[model samples]
Target: MTHSKRYQHRTIISFFTVLIVFILMAGGVQAGIEPSKVICRVETDRAILPAGDSQNVVLKITLDAPPSPAHIKRPLVNLALVLDQSGSMSGTKIQQAKAAAIEAAIEALTRLGLQDIFSVVVYDTNVHTIVPAQRAGNIQSIINTIQQIRAGGSTALFGGVSQGASEIRKKLESDYVHRIILLSDGLANVGPRMPEDLGRLGAALIKENISVTTVGVGTDYNEDLMTRLAQKSDGNTYFVESGFDLPRIFAAELGDVLNVVAKKVKVTITLSDNVEAINIIGREGRIRENQIEFYMNQLYGDQEKYALVEVNIPKSTSGSRIKIAQVDVTYENPFSRKPEKSTGISYASFSSDSGKVARSTNIEVIREYQLNLNALAQEKAIELSDQGKKKE
Candidate 1:
């Protein structure tokens, strides 16, 4: 080949090599900051009745996320702590719970800054106030009140919850993160309402923009009821098997509760005419009337927070589709609501092959596990009934 031709060929090869390098760099950048989607699971089970006439169906939804250090801030917290002073919590349980409450209050007072407001509500047959809505400066007094509490009488879990929620309702007007932290060891035995009725009451409180977090201390506690209460109120539920675990759980979560970055964050999806149905499963979605609402359950100090929602798409024959889900977040601004507006939006496209959007596996597992447990419980109940008949 001539020298000029050879030079031209070499130039072409270099051009293609440079193009490949540019493409590889672009791919790496895309991989580094890939968009994430949330997942939610729903599980159900059916059990035969004693007369073999009907079946009961139980449903559960589980929420989860990829493991990461949670971004936390000192929340403007208005907290009402409803402690169980029932007969079962008399000795060590009451002592440890009191110690945990004191530690939580002091930690919030010192670490969460002075903006945090704290309160204490202790209950046995009835709810009593230790410290009403007050600033962190009075945390020492609250701690002293916790120490003075003693366990007695039957458990009035429902009454305590209702009273705590009422106290939180008073603080709802303030631009604060309102919450009630309930610690219990048994089912409701003294309240006029049933557990389910109390759950509905808690759900109503959630509608008023208040959340309730429940902690079940010890194995005898009614875990199912506590879990449902948290779920209904858009709050978190924790199980403490021993006293040793109380301090850390309280310290970590109480800090997060008090210093919330956003309040009343909600997401709504608007589908095109072709789309049929949308289901959101996880800590994210709550169905309210015609629209589904998603709350930002946890917030790191930063302005940005993460949420996941799963959409089910029906197969379409048309090569093109137009469906949009808008994520709208409404957060309380410490300042003026007009100047510092409380809303945000993120868009998801159904056509994108990029795996930025997908279903959540944690939701699926939670649903299946709950369903299986429900089925097992029903079977055991039936077996016991048969055994009693045989003895007769």
Candidate 2:
């Protein structure tokens, strides 16, 4: 061949080589940029998985820290005030409880400026709604109802909460933040009184986009029950040693309720056909075939919520990339009063070479995984010690 023809042939070959390299790297690139609503990141411990092996994947979802008061546009609130009026809550505790409720009600009337709703239910042996849900215009009537409440009978903690929830249901609206704030200074001694029952009830309320925050005043209340109820409902739990602190805790709960930015947040993670989702660690989620779904009642101004999914991988050929899972989030944006969504995908490459897998390890994922393991170990140790077993 002539020299000029040879030079042109070499240039053509180099161009085709570069094109092939780009095509190979394209699969490693992320599908799109992260969503603005949340910081979602999917990380695997290593980039390459061994054939026929399983791996754990962590989804780190975070919202920016709580904004300043001036920056947050408070939403309309539908609040249920469930107060314990048993004999144990007499004197200072009951007086302080009434004060807290009044303070919270006054703030809603003066500062929120929205069409906020309020309901009051005080419980003893029986539960009754002192004030059914209404606009925050009747401050005098509410104060009178609260003052009439006198502590005497046995505690009907469950009954009071259920009655409060029913009151909020009467005026439930999509735009309003629905919440039940329960304050108790005594154990539940009447009606269906069980921690599991309260937890299940709290979980059911979350499905209706309502969260329950619990406040335990004094040491007589069941801390375990209070915490479980709040956790199941994605709400806050507070403990007050002094009755005087009731007002502050109530105010803090009101602040959190008004600062809600997103509601009805749902996360769905679908694993690829080649992989089987084994289980979800830490958080409770529903599993349908290979997909996992989690329902969150509300997302506050600053919070981080995440789930870790473990998957089993089928054997694959070397130098091939496989999609691990696709995560989609749907939420009601309070600012826009419309539904918004974000999507992300996770991928892992397979390699026969062990060295490549070692080099591609994601340090962040490994560190997090190790930390989770450490936590689990500590929990197990505590459990064993509680059972009267030696550490060794």
Candidate 3:
């Protein structure tokens, strides 16, 4: 072969090599990653604080899914997709939802394999189980069943969720990540329609390690009811303004579900005597005395979960340092298939110079703190509006 031809061949090989590398890396915290790697950190928004009493401070506990190479086993997921087929979801809404459900099923089959389980449940005025809970193997069958879902009748939101939860309980196992993805666009007009009824059900399901994620389509759905159920069960919620967003949202949610690295995660932060934990912002938790406890149902391999504790820092002498937090984290490792725990402690320093305290602020932690505070304020605004006190 000629030298020029050989050089050209080598260049072609290098280009293909680079392309393959880029494609693999683009998956980004997704499935087929080493699942046991979780990095825990406890940090104060500012390592140095002004030397004063009852100063506002933020304590952050972060659980990060560490980056890793591909091809590793993750925990099995048992997902029950509860879809709404009400009269209001007759046009683009129903079609988009069906397509999204089919896409999600295909994605789940590709990632979840034979070890994981999936089912389909649809509801209007009456509840129906389209696909029974079973190991994920027949993607075609699930797709066909989902396509048959037609829009008609009023919405029995409570019955739909209750049925999905029942389906998940069929294969309830200690190691499986049990969850229900509820998609609805209308109000609950049937029996047991109140938000409190669904909230009570969510609370009950969580005791058995089941979470319900509520996706509200358009603005017609009761956001309060949806959010309440999700919050009580330690699940995420989403609001989509248009039907076109359903497919993307379902795919993204399924990706996260398949990439779970840790489950049954428990984080407990005990503050020092001199420090008082006021509340947990952005997420739900129990703040009692000096101890703050929260339960994170699942952690995805490509996401970072954190808790912001609004704290009160007591007066300290200048040039003195104080220990503020003792953080303990426990979770079931999906890769190792075993339980593990880790502990970390955070401290803060007092400075007489305001510039020193400003310089010591961790920008990332502070940004998160401010964002969560804004979210808390928005939540309060919504609550006030709902209570017939919008003028306030």
The C-alpha TM-scores of every prediction are 0.62, 0.74, 0.84
lDDT of 2 by residue, 185-219 (tens): 78998987778989999988887778899988778
**Candidate 1: pairs in clash:** 38-308, 39-360, 40-281, 41-363, 43-367, 71-300, 74-259, 75-258, 75-259, 75-260
Task: Give residue 170's error in model 2 in angstroms.
Answer: 1.9
Worst 10 residues of 1 by lDDT: 22-31
Q: State the local distance difference test value for candidate 1.
A: 0.50
Q: Return the clash pairs for model 2, or none.
A: none
**Model 1 lDDT tens row, 1-392:** 44433332232222222211221121100112211222233332211112211222222322222222233222356677777766656434323433444444444334334544556676778778666766545433444555556556788888788778777767778766777888776667786545577678667878887778888877878766787788778787899775446656566555456334445544454433333333443344555433456565444343233333333334432123223233333444322222112332222223223232233123443455455557657758866766758531
Between prediction 1 and prediction 3, which has the larger lDDT?
3
User: Considering every candidate listed, which one attains the maximal lDDT?
Assistant: 3
List ranges where model 3 is wrong by over 4 Å.
Answer: 1-36, 52-54, 93-112, 387-392
